[model samples]
Target chain A: MVTYIWVFFVIVGSFFTIFTGNVEALNNEILKGGADGLKLLSEMLPLLVLWTGIMQVAEDSKILELFSNLVRPFLCKLFPSLPKNHPALGYIASNICANALGLGSAATPFGLKAMECLQEDNPCKDTATEAMITFLVLNTGGVTIVPTTVIALRLMHGSANPSEIIITSILATLCSNVSGLIYDYFKRRKKHG
Target chain B: MANFLVPIFVLGIILYAFKQKVNIYESFLVGAKDGLVTTFKIAPAVIAMVFATNIFLNSHFLDFVFSYFTPFLEAVGIPNSILPMAMVRPISGTASLAIMSNIFELYGPDSFVGRLASNLQGCTDTTIYVLALYFSSIKVTKTKHALSAGLFADFVGIVAAFIITFLFFG
Candidate 1:
């Protein structure tokens, strides 16, 4: 239902731009965009491998368990139904950690795993549960500390001070996460009531 | 040379020390394989979207839109130089990155608009990519509400990045 509206919006937006004479510029943009995309894909490959390897090692070492224990008190407040030793909890922690470091590419598997684990415990057959909703909010507004992808882009672009945005990124993410959590809390209350 | 070599040597020693009896090499290979698989799964959508965004920007439509958006963006403390990147960001991360780099090169990194643009890049996701990948992976055939909400979230991120930078840095 809602998806239709979204598609409409994208179509309209694209058409609107095209009508405004941008469509004529498509050939150049396509070539440049392809080159840029390929470059990014290439640069990201090695870093992706490194981080994925590290995450696997972390999993093998039960380091995620230690990290989960460290974050438990805070996570409990956010996800009360999530048991401390639950597989979902560990995955959630790893996802949050990876997100915080701005390694979203690294976070995807953990996010998927968390969702899978949560679904296993879901009593409802179809709809997403309260925990799932909360997880979605958290992931959507996940606090980023390093903003690595942005930094990489900046560096690629020739920024003299690529790292300077770090402070602003931290503050903005903090605010968004706090507000998003508040929104989730109020929305959940309405749903339950 | 020493500055670079020292860190490499230290990292090598650490890796060696941390090496366990387990077949770490095989495990790493498996993980890499999985990552490649995910990348491949996303390849088509990513490529098409990237091409589309490139066309949009190159076609001068972006310039036309930016002219109208200039005053509004200025009100939010985003200079004209940063507008293109901000507009492209929601559609494509890599492209926005290219624009960010261009701005950094032109204005120098410490300039207000340059910093703000870079910050906005960090703060937001490629909204379309998120929608395409996550929902598709879950077999979500419908995404109307999610799309609206996600785009709204991105709008908030962009505005917030600008305002926060203005308040703090400007």
Candidate 2:
């Protein structure tokens, strides 16, 4: 509810600014920005295909399963309702894997599949399940090591050292993931308690 | 070179393990098929999001917001170059990528703002798009709480990115 309100304000605010002609420079900005965006996307294709192929190989070889097993103990602690071998675990692993590589497009299927698998065990038709809540937390704060997408954008923009942001990216993701996990923990505790 | 070699070695080991047991090519093809299907399913929403971002940006509204939020952003250690990104981050990844590229072009990659903007781009997401698509696909009718929670997470991401960048690059 409050979120919608904030969005409404943001929209109205942006429009108000536009109406005041405060953004007349945007015409040229968009023209330049769009071209650059397309170029970046083009350059990103090879990397995206490479990572997608690697992820496919990972899935085919059950390396994803292996990864899931490694994370299962911690995930189980976070999401008690999810059974030991729930399909959502695989989807979650894939989603996390794609995200770590900074492949947001590639992460979508895995996220959707994870949610679907979670829905299987959701007793309440309307309320989000514990698994769903936890998955949301993980998705929102998923660790991103390479941040390939951003690096690609940097490369497109002619950044000399596109990879320099790797350390900061990792740190920020770690913080977000930790905070998300902590928030979920207390939220769940409060709900049950 | 070592950075590039590591990933190749990892892939090679995985392939070697699967040799003679499973048809690696066939399995990969199957997975690719699934990937293509998922891509198509989400294409419409992604396109709509891209279009919306284009409109918002072209309308010049984002610039105004950036100006308005300049002081607050600076207070948080975010440079002006990264401000456009902060505005676009919640709108569309593609649009944000475009903005990022422009920044990189105007200011070389090593420039503080360019680097920070690029990093922040990776760290955050198109929160509105994610909320709409994820909730809709799952038939989530009332998105009140989810929206609030997701945006709150995005806010944290923005602040975290600024702080991390400042600490590491400042």
lDDT of 2 by residue, A27-143 (tens): 454445455545544553444444445556666677667778988897788778778887678778777776787767567667876776777776766566666766776676647
Off by over 4 Å in 1: A1-10, A13-54, A119-133, A149-164, B1-26, B29-33, B36-63, B71-78, B142-153
* C-alpha lDDT (0 to 100) for residue B32 of candidate 2: 60
For B37-121, candidate 2 gives per-residue lDDT tens digits of: 5444544444444434555555655676678877886897655657777767766676677777877778767777776776677
The number of residue pairs in model 2 that clash at the backbone is 1
What docking grade does candidate 1 earn?
Answer: acceptable
Residue A38 deviation, candidate 1, in Å? 8.4
Lowest summed-lDDT stretch of 10 residues in model 1 chain B? B1-10
By lDDT, the best candidate is 2
Q: Look at candidate 2 and tell me the lDDT of residue B135.
A: 54
- What is the per-residue lDDT of model 1 for residues A10-61, given as tens digits with 9 covering 90 to 100? 4554666567666645445544666766665566566556655555555565
